[model samples]
Target: MDLNYSPYDFGIHNDPYPVYARLREEAPVFRNEPDDVWVLSRHADVQAALRDSATFSSVNGLRIEPAFWGPDAERFFSFVAMDPPRHTRVRGLVSRAFTHRRVQELEPRLRELARAYLDPLLDGEPFDLMTDFAGPFLADVISELVGVPEADRGEVRRLGAAIMYRDEESTDLPPEALQAIGALVGYYAELTRERARGRRDDLLSGLLDAAEGDDRLTLEEIVGVAILLVGAGIETSMLTLGNAWYAAWRHPDQRARAFDGRVADWIEETLRYDPPPQALARTTTAEVELHGTTLPAQSRVLLLIGSANRDPRVFPDPDRFDLDRDTGSSLAFGSGRHHCLGANLGRLETRIALEEIVKVVADYDIDTDGLRRIHSTNNRGFATLPTNVTARR
Candidate 1:
């Protein structure tokens, strides 16, 4: 099979499993000339690239281009684009706020919040699950946790969305979108400054006070983290929950089994089956040999996370959506030092979501025509998943 994989193609986004399988079998280290990025479709190849951060640096900010590789990009991206010592310092500061214990403690409050958002939709009325529930829930959770003022949370999400709406193929940049990112950065910077003046009971305040001595994150670093938290925390969580529902509704047999202790398996399977973050880019630091091909130094490589999770070499019957599938090796949240920091938060949110859903909704039907797939190079999931939610009782 002559593999032609373009992340921007809507057809591929809609159902990329078949194409992913073909790439895994025929061209594990496929070159997507159209996008000017090398793609790693197989699990072994993607895992290798992720593990060797020195060879494939994140300093170029995932996907490389003139717009994102500019000087200011370093200040804006902070840790995500950094290599070692800097990445360690920033990650350490941010990690304190998202500890396993902290996430566990958030459960009670999250359950209450989940109930507040979900109770109204149990009236058998049509609800756009993605827009109405999943999206808002994640936005609210992350904003509240990060200490964004209640009045400003909505605006933050709006601006953040605009900033994140990237089209890798487009040459012209959207001024308004850039402005939105600018505004968001300023918003977080102010929050960071306020925390510096006097500590508040929030993540921003915690970051300001998080250090024994001179070792600490600068104002720009804090702001970068705030943006990172929001960007990385929301979309994947929102989509995972929405896609889980999409899966449950589409496969009742699996849904029935999910009511028991197996819901965790269902969630794990969903991550492997149809993850939100479909791909991420890494820049080659030096020339590297992959399979029989040589990836030149300074070239861009797009790691097809969605494709890798479905590699038949790693997973049998790769196309089938099975709740019982063993997903121990799934590359959903990724691997290596650059692995997702918000992975725990995402899993917690997803579990609580499914638990709440099973409580209120025993049977639901999807309006397939009402579904809208989000067209993004790095993300995959429905933008709108309309369902007539029914109450259990």
Candidate 2:
């Protein structure tokens, strides 16, 4: 085992695909100290582990550092911490909300919301695509879905950013941040009770009804799932939006093809090339052998989802972002039992955002001078992207 690459101290935050490529080739399962965890870099290994939940459990929580969960770490780590029957039960209930009918119903409204934000941002002068458009677009959509008032959306965005910070040193959330999470949880809990009491016609109401039996999700579970859904929704979708715009501006030919119904494929390529959730953690429930190394029970396995997506074994010319190439099963969304229940919703969000942007904004350029990455091990995205966009004349 050549002990050369420093997985913890990866300097190239701007472009980490190269590092992931190296890890996949040399040490498929690399160990690092910054987070003090073992990273699985190969696609096959990560995929297998994701599918085999019995060996690799989500119980220890998905974050590398415990602080990523902030104050509600214990009280809110339900959906992400459950295994087997419990995991299936909770996920199934939430899955009902995002079913084809519900999401399809939400599409027209979602597109209207996209246009509402996009048109304002597309006014004459240069605007930051991320702050002015992507961020607000996603934040607003999630807010509307969870019954958040339009006025409170900013505060929600603020707290969401603070709580989703990736840098291990970012635990100092202002009082308002805590309040934001509490308010969100309180709102959802009340909404859950309301849906339970009176048969409402919304998705939240359906989830509330789903929590009735012995396998019923607890109030805490309801709050946790709501928080997870809302937080995860805004962050990842916004990241995809920003990344897609960046990818398009960088590749002119690709952008043209992307506009022609190939944006979904392009988004898939972007995810494989540079996913928002760069890496994920799973605690081993039993001794497991991966790549000739014996991982003891309870040992944490850090799946480098971005790395796996770029593994040469799985994708030919893995580094190249070819929209036509059928890159098999990228772990942009997690695999197996605990896979993202909001996968379809996330895709719809990204697709609609791209469609709106591509149609309204003609010329674009990345303002690399001030771009910043969110500081979180669990979620990878930009905090501030100072880009200039020209609306179609």
Candidate 3:
């Protein structure tokens, strides 16, 4: 059977697993010439590529889209698109401010934010979970962390969403996306300057003050990191929440368990079953031979994270979403040096949101017919999930 895979395809965006399964079995190192990408679809291969960053570099941003790829990728992905010692230096400074203690301290506020949005949605009427809750909640969390003023957060969220979204089958960024990027960068650049003058008790202030020895982030670097947080941090967390909600709605047994306070398990299984980051793009730094095929130097490669998570070799009965199954090997947040810096905060936000959700929401039903998904080259999740809940008295 002939293999044809394009990440830009809307059909693939809708459900790429079947294609991924075929690629893993038939072409572990599949090459899609149309998109000019080398695909690695096995658990071991993807993991190895992630760990071997030297061989599979992130110099070109993590997405294959024309707008996000190449030398300027750092403008969008920040240090995530860089190789060491640049990546090492920038991540170290950012880490100083984005400490574990800081994330841990936000729990109370996160819980409050979750309930603030969830309370009105419990009026026994159908609502779009993405619009009414997940989007706003995660946006608020990121906004609060970044010190985006309360009044400006809605526009910030809109800009962030525009940057990640794609028109069906499009390979490059649209005009609106470009406009959003410019606007977001300007906004953050001003915010960084504002904090530089007088620090506040937020991440922006922390970023301004974050230092290692005599080194510090420049104004442009801080703006880039802020944009990265808005684009990568908020989008993935928001999508993950929706993905988790949908996964539970699809499986009654898992839904029941999740409702019974097994939210962490629910998150793990959902991440394994249908992760938000379906694929990650990398650039091959040197020639390499793998799976009986040789990939040339500087070739664009896509590590199929979604496929790797479902590889039967790593997880038994991988297709099934069992809350009890161990998901320690899942690459949902990636691995190695590029392992998500915001993983702790993402988990905290999700846990708080869901924990509060399970309190007010005894059970819920999703309108499958009304479901709509966001189309992007890599990310996967709903744009609109029409839902009705059975509120708890």
Off by over 4 Å in 3: 164-172
Q: Sort all candidates by lDDT, best to worst.
A: 3, 1, 2
TM-score of each: 0.93, 0.90, 0.97
Choose 2 or 3, whichever is better by TM-score: 3
> Of the candidates shown, which would achieve the greatest lDDT relative to the real structure?
3
Identify the leading candidate in terms of TM-score: 3
Clash pairs (backbone) in predicted model 3: none
Expressed as tens digits, the lDDT of each residue in 330-383 for candidate 2 is 898999887887778888889888887778776677778877776555556677
Task: Compute the lDDT for candidate 2.
Answer: 0.73
Per-residue lDDT of model 3, residues 142-163, tens digit only: 8888888989988987887777
Error of 1 at 319 (Å): 1.7
lDDT of 1 by residue, 1-393 (tens): 456888767788789888887888888888878678888888888988888889888877754445565335565456777778777777887787557776677788778878888988887679998877887777778787778888997898688666544443443336877787688888889888888888877778877777746777688778888777766777778888888888877788888889755778889999998998788788888898978899999888888889888887889997788987889999898789988888888898889877888887777889999888776767788778998966877
lDDT for 270 in candidate 1 is: 93
